[model samples]
Target: MSKTISFVLNGRQRSVQVDDPEMPLLYALRNDLGLHGPRFGCGLAQCGACTVHVEGKAVRSCTFPVAQAAGAKLLTLEGLGTPERPHALQKAFIEEQAVQCGYCI
Candidate 1:
């Protein structure tokens, strides 16, 4: 059965229909919401590539259940800032030349 999961994404209200509530939140964010900020690194959640903020805490979206994120606030990299005005961390990274492959930023 398809279940509707609602959450605050990037300061906007959003909802997605998930067949399995246990499905990873990353799939909903990436495939359903069309967000490319989070990447699937290690499915084991050892890597922090799929890290996203939920309820003001960092979480590995790869293993996080979409159901658990219902009615919660989610913040992805895209929510940080725009190209015209980058976030402080993003600006610092560019100034310090910390960006490399841009995979695990």
Candidate 2:
């Protein structure tokens, strides 16, 4: 059975129905909420592509259980900034042209 998991997503309070509490937060963010910022790299969490900010700290969403995020705040790449006012790192990356495929951007 699916259970509702409530959390703050990019500063907005949101809830998602998770069938398995052990389900990765990546799935909830992508399949459920339709977010594309976090890439699905190595499903084993060995790669850094599935990184997301949880309560201001980086966490591997691919292997992170959705239940563990209840009531916590989450931030994805898209939440980092906007085109009009990109984040410092974002601006630096653009200036340096240090991005390709954007899997870990």
Candidate 3:
């Protein structure tokens, strides 16, 4: 059965309908809404590739169910910074040239 879920994404309130409550939050962020900043790495949540801030705390999106994220605030890389005016993390990463293979960038 499909259920409608609402939450805050990048400080913006948004909602979507999902058929499965156990579906990973990463899929909802990337596939459903077309937010590509948080990438998919190990589905087992071993890697930190899908790290996103949920209610001001970092969470592994791959392991977090979409239903569990309802009504919570989510902050992905897109929310942390932008191309025109970047955030401190983005600025630091670029200034220090800390990017490897452009994966984290």
**Span of 10 residues, lowest total lDDT, candidate 3:** 96-105
Better of 2 and 3 by lDDT: 2
The worst-scoring run of ten residues by lDDT in candidate 1 lies at: 96-105
Q: For candidate 2, what is the total of clashing residue pairs?
A: 0
Q: After superposition, how far is residue 4 of candidate 3 from its true place, in Å?
A: 0.6
Model 3 TM: 0.91
Q: Which candidate leads in TM-score? A: 1
Cα deviation of 38, candidate 2, in Å = 0.7
| Candidate 2 residue-wise lDDT, 21-75, digit = tens | 9999999999999998898988988888889999999999999999999999999
Tens digits of per-residue lDDT for model 1, 1-105: 999999999999999999999999999999999999998999778888999999999999999999999999999999999999999999999999895686564
How far in Å is the alpha carbon of 49 misplaced in model 2?
0.8
lDDT of 2 at 46: 88
List candidate 3 stretches off by more than 4 Å.
Answer: 102-105
Error of 1 at 94 (Å): 1.5
> Model 1: what TM-score?
0.93
Each model's lDDT: 0.95, 0.92, 0.89
RMSD (Cα, Å) for all candidates, in order, is 1.5, 1.8, 1.7
TM-score for each of the candidates:
0.93, 0.91, 0.91
